[model samples]
Target: MSKIADNIESTPHSDLAKGDEHSVKTGRILVAIATYNEIENLPILVERLVDTLPEADLLVIDDGSPDGTGQWCEEHAKMNVRMHCLHRKGKPGLGSAIIAAMQYAIDNNYDVMVNLDADLSHPPEKIPELLEAWRLADSDSTVAIGSRYIHGGGISGWPLKRHFMSRAINMYTRWLLWLPMADCSGSFRAYPVNLLRKIDFDSFLSYGYSFFEEVLYHLKEQGASFVEVPFQFVERQYGSSKINMRKAIVAVWTIFRLGLKAWNPF
Candidate 1:
């Protein structure tokens, strides 16, 4: 079972404007982070987010981290009015944690939901750039992406092998899934909550890191548009990476499967 420790009260969906149309420019925004043993990096991330985006609310979905990451979130939520924490049992998949945040955003009637990693690799200061791009987007279905492959954006502190692996995976996903964006695998993305509501969470096949790419595929199926915002992706300053060879293999296989299904949905 999951538990919530939140400072903000639940706002009714009826409070939203009628006709199901919502504008991100005027609607509430949520910044969500999915974490597992991210306590070492999370505090600094929280501080940066609070300082950088004072108007946006924050949500942390922790998967029962052994390092007391969930506990820290609970304690911090009490002091921060805009922060909320969802504590899930055991170490569930990364995708599930993000799905929970998506549900929370929907339930709370947020118009825009921005998701980022808790490891500080995705810069908190870049969030406003994504939001600004969202505000200026030509369509409401736009998913503003913080892309590292785009011009004016790059990666820092990664070895040649790691860089090659990342670029290869992105290339593979885009070619197979027909994803137009350059950085489809990165977690730094701003999603329109209204578009998220159109997707059926129970139908999703990805429960791991593949969720990042799979989500874009599904969003595109729902007529979602793309807007790439360049941002430098810095390697985490603290804590080891959660991804391993096993996870990467699974993600690749899953993307291949998704591609086949995309070509012929039986």
Candidate 2:
């Protein structure tokens, strides 16, 4: 178990000095979302999250987008103490951004953490259910994934090729890495700070889109349990996708490399 997880598991949510959990009726939570030119979506997403998880704080990890996303994050943080923003020097890969967010959560002593896209495809309303899952489980190692492949879960406003590719990615990772997850490529996830801290970011492998699956595989190896919550996944309304055909191809190659390395670690 991570030291942070150990601290939270032994300590009750009522004891946190930062924000009280009773308002949200959940633990001392931190919601993390990575951004790169998400100005159009970030504001509405942040507002909805504030209302949904009243007690939980939201962290925006901005990659210094040309858009004023980082500036908005700073200004918004002034008004709402619950909002925190981290501005990177440049646009790093998705994996690095997520790792940074997880690090911040661990450093700040939050009891639970949820990571979703800035695009609002992962509804903030489903947050309660994720926290509920953690509450029911006896271990702080429980991770809840907002899955689209699970029963009662699916996507909307996605092209057939995109949908098919998503399914194929899951199948590929599930078979190669032996992952039990149905939505290996999905970014909507909830994790305990302790469990996330246990991951070694120093030697972290993979980049770009493959980062999500790489994380799931490592977490499973560490004995962390998972819960899949079905939800409607929607396409982004604003901003073009950062992923390109070249990155997609590289992600596949990286996955195979990661799988082999894990299976036969030297």
Query: Tens-digit lDDT track for model 1 on 1-266?
Result: 11222322332223221213335355688899988888899999999999998777888888778998988987887777678777777666888888888888887778899999999989999988898898888999999999999999999999999999999999999999999999999989999999998988877778799999999999999999999999999998888898999999999999999999888888
The superposed Cα distance between candidate 1 and the true structure at residue 245, in angstroms, equals 0.3
| Every model's TM-score | 0.91, 0.90
Clashes of 1: 0
Give the lDDT of residue 21 in candidate 1. 36
Per-residue C-alpha lDDT of model 2 across residues 1-266, encoded as one tens digit per residue: 22212211111122232665444336578899989999999999998998898778888888887999988988887778777777776665887778777876787678788999999899999988877877787776988888999899999999999988888988999988888878889988888877877788665567478999999988988889888889999999988888888999989998999889777978
Query: Any residue pairs clashing in model 2, and if so which?
Result: none
Residue 241 lDDT, candidate 1, scale 0-100:
91
lDDT of 2: 0.81
Model 2: how far is 239 from its true place, Å?
1.7
| Candidate 2 ranges beyond 4 A from true positions | 1-25
